[model samples]
Target chain A: MDEETAKMIADKGAWLCLQPFLDDEDAIPFPEGTPQRTKQLAMVAGTENAYRLAKKHNIKTAFGTDVLFDAELAAKQGKQLAKLQRWYTPFEVLKMATFNNAQLLKFCGPRDPYPGELGVIKEGALADMILVDGNPLQNLDLIIDPTKNFVLIMKDGKIYKNTIQFK
Target chain B: MLFLYGLLGRAQETAEKNTILIINATVFDGQNEKMQEGMSILVEGNKIAKIAKTINIPQTAQVVNAQGKVLMPGLIDAHAHPMFAGISQQAGLTSQDGYLNLVAAKTAEKFLMQGFTSLREASGNSISLKCAIDQGLYLGPRIYPTGPMISQTSGHADYRPSTSIPYDPNATLSYIERSGHALIADGVPEIIKGVRSVLRMGATQVKLGAGGGVASIYDPLDVTQYTFEELKAAVDVAETWNTYVMVHAYTPKAIQTSLGPG
Candidate 1:
């Protein structure tokens, strides 16, 4: 993004739904000079600059991973979030994924399908939460291995996973 | 894996008590930067009833000791394609008999297990899959579906080969179209219809292929799609239904052109 675009985003109060997609283990390599490979490189080359400009202009940013046609890439969702630590603090990264992303969802207004508070651990909010084995803010990389780190996952107050053993 | 599945299954059975008290948790409430240590939370039904340093645990509540672990709101993905995320390109176009959706279901399950509670669909036919997840028949994130991305012929979303050319209106829809993957729409009337069609399918918003896309082979990355009238028609239709349109664009001209309409 250029300064002008970043300024426009800030001026319009628009949310920059940004993703930290990189050429990592998640991506399947395309042969050189193919349309897919050229496009992928062009798409990725702008990401870092976009983030810096968005932050410099204080644009409202949301985190996402636009994974498609790749199951292996889909599994790296947490790693993508962790990748944000390069540009933001661990707390800021979590906040972007949780709070900021939900703000964009809430922007849907009456069209919101699951109408209720989301992406917050507060009284009267929808009971969507994750119980991590370790403090995520201190050790954000733990999220990359969710099977062992995310001990419990809850949505709508339902326990979808509870790996914790109680005596 | 079997033993863990057994535990998870048992947890589900007991989790229906509608009230749960999580004690001794390190709280990182989404809005706050500071983390609270040794906090507790009480959930009643599908909402958080209380969160404080201490809570009087009801005898009926299912108490879980957090063991001072961190608790935070589940993650949300602003742009995702749950219906297409886990499948290969070949499988996306060739796999028959609902095989793609089964893989999508697995992807959704993994999404939740990895702590993503909600997903906003960027483009895909996700309504039925979302319904199944909502009905508790499958495990996945809460989804807001867009049905399909509207596109013009030779635009970003076109999936037709040269073999199926000459633009025969009476011809049968392509497999991708019939399966609700993409809508090849052009002109004002078709744009309006496409927007309304997705809304009728319960799309939270309409998505438009307003420019060329990387995955779209036919159009170049610099090409801007949808004339002013057509883009305006889509926006007008979406507004009539009290919704909006989201476009996929990558270039200055493409972005500026769509911005002109919306």
Candidate 2:
């Protein structure tokens, strides 16, 4: 498609979901030079290209990690987002994961299960939120360990967790 | 002394209201370039009522001084398999459904505590687990279940014993297959039926084993599993139901074959 068309869709909030960590060398446990490993390398290159193109065209982007099979690896999802810092600023990565992804979910139309607004802190928005102990924009590494960094979690306006006393 | 006690009683009465006010928080707002500090957020009945540098606190609102904590939106996992529960493949064959469900329940809560508010189930037996959480029978993230992974005989999802004959009416399903975790289907018609069965079981998406897997006992890493016709049939059924099909494939050829002309 033309740049003009790309910009038009981006302006309306089209999202390009990027998962750089999926292509990391450690992602595939196969031996080096194996067909599976080589394929993973190609996949990584493809992902990098897609990221470059999205950035060049100013397409709206979102963070994603297609982690499956291993629960241990899946728990490290935050690290996947931090890996994006290699090609993007921490602030940009954070925004893509939150606001941009939220906008993308709106494309689900009537199939969207959560009807209320999400991915932001504003009046009338759904209160599905988290409280981090440290500023992630300044130190994205803090997000890598949710247990230590995330002090509180609130979903649907109900407090699921609160480490600090709040009476 | 009597007037002071009465005033204290009134204050306690106000605190009983369900409103919460969080102040002195370094709010991320999930979209802003810079973190806004010393902000106050008002939560009323499960929705953000107001957010500003200063908010009027009601007499009954429970106020929390955040001490400059970073506040942002809850995280999301686009691909997850909460039902897998880290159990060994051999153990999976022997474990009872009730035991497996319990493990899934624990796994789901752990995900929520880790700040994942929502997840998309990649495969496994997650339909009932999703229902349990949605119905308030258990605590978990908002799940988008795929039900089971569909595979051709000896494909990536095939966890059957090597001796088990394919498409034998007299033979019973393997424990993994009998557990609603996966389906072994071959040919275009079987693939279509498999896709439709999952859709009927509350699946929002379909997962097809379109390539060889490292864990498969029979298929090699380079082999493509389902034919284009079989893949197309699965996709067509998914499309008819307003959903999409996701395939498990790694190599270039396997991935290309899945995407070919379908």
Which candidate leads the pack in TM-score?
Answer: 1
Off by over 4 Å in 1: B1-16
What TM-score would chain B receive for each of the candidates shown?
0.91, 0.84
Residue-level lDDT of model 1, residues A67-159, one tens digit each, is 888888788789878999979999999999998888888776788888889989999999999999888888999889988999989999989
lDDT of each: 0.85, 0.74
> Could you give candidate 2's per-residue lDDT for residues B50-129 as a string of tens digits?
99999988886878778868889887665567886444445555678888788778778878887877766768879899
Which window of 10 residues has the lowest lDDT sum in candidate 2 chain A? A1-10
* Candidate 1 displacement at residue B178 in angstroms: 1.0
Q: Alpha carbon lDDT of residue B121, candidate 1?
A: 90
TM-score of each: 0.93, 0.78
Model 1 residue pairs with clashes: none
Among incorrect, acceptable, medium and high, the docking class of model 2 is acceptable
- When superposed on Cα atoms, how far off is each prediction in RMSD? 3.8, 6.1
